[model samples]
Target: MATTSCDVAIVGAGLGGCFLAMLLRRRGQNVVVIEQGPSIPSAGADFLKPPGLRVLARHGLADLVGRHGLRRDHIRYYHDGDPIQDCRFPDGGFLIRPYRELVELIYTCCAMEGVEFWFGAEIGDIAVGGGGVEELTLADGRRLRAGVVVGADGTRSL
Candidate 1:
């Protein structure tokens, strides 16, 4: 088996994982993202809320993500054919984009920052020591050692 090391090993390539990887990489951390799927996930939430958009803007990625996304500022609810309530959003409202597209965009940014990605990687075993992860072994016999390990693999993650 071959062994490799990185500053951070993230177990997922989903939005959170990829976005975090990009941010960490921008801060000069050596990051490796491991995903069990063949590629970035194709299904997920389609709305980028205000808080999330703010975070992206803080990182100078708001424009990139919003370039082709649909923008909405308000949503109205009706009851019995009568206008009930109108919910207005602040800060240009939220963005409407497919989950995969959003993730791919962030993934591209992470790649440009030199964050390594290992797709179709299945975790075989995780070694923990001193209340933290020490190493991760892949199903294909590859080992990864990192200063920090994050299980952003999602709701069904290990």
Candidate 2:
């Protein structure tokens, strides 16, 4: 088939993938995001946590986060039907959302920002070069060449 090239090639559309795509696109860089799975929705839970909170704040998503995030107060540690410790949050809180939803939102933002997406494309082999990534062979026999390749395919990624 046809071969494509990009400044950056992201393997998965997970949190890091999407955020990186957004950042690069904002800087006027061409990026190709390849996903082996279908895009899902994004829930704003990670935005409410500590590190992610700071990160989202930098991205200007903190306000939206407070509106849609969950506040986790305490956790009860159980030891075989016995309560071991009850952890409490004094000033800090945690938030979480479904993983599928997060992926969906990322994909949506990528689309709006004109990031090229290759869904259902399973990567077979990869070649790295001095400049950057040389080539990627997909399961469908399609070849993708790029100056940079990022492995955001998550756990169990090839």
Mark the 10 consecutive residues where model 1 has the least summed lDDT.
Answer: 149-158
RMSD of each: 2.3, 3.0
Candidate 1 — which pairs collide? none
Candidate 1 overall Cα lDDT vs. reference?
A: 0.93
lDDT string for model 1 (27-134, tens) is: 999999999999998888998989999999999999999999999988788999999999889878999999999999999999988999999999999999998999
Give me the runs in candidate 1 sitting further than 4 Å from their true place: 76-86
lDDT (CA) for every model shown? 0.93, 0.74
- lDDT for model 2: 0.74
Tens-place lDDT per residue, model 2, 19-134, is: 89988988888999888875532422343456676786798655655555567867788999999998775566666556555556556777899999888888888877786669
TM-score of 1: 0.91
lDDT score, candidate 2, position 56: 68
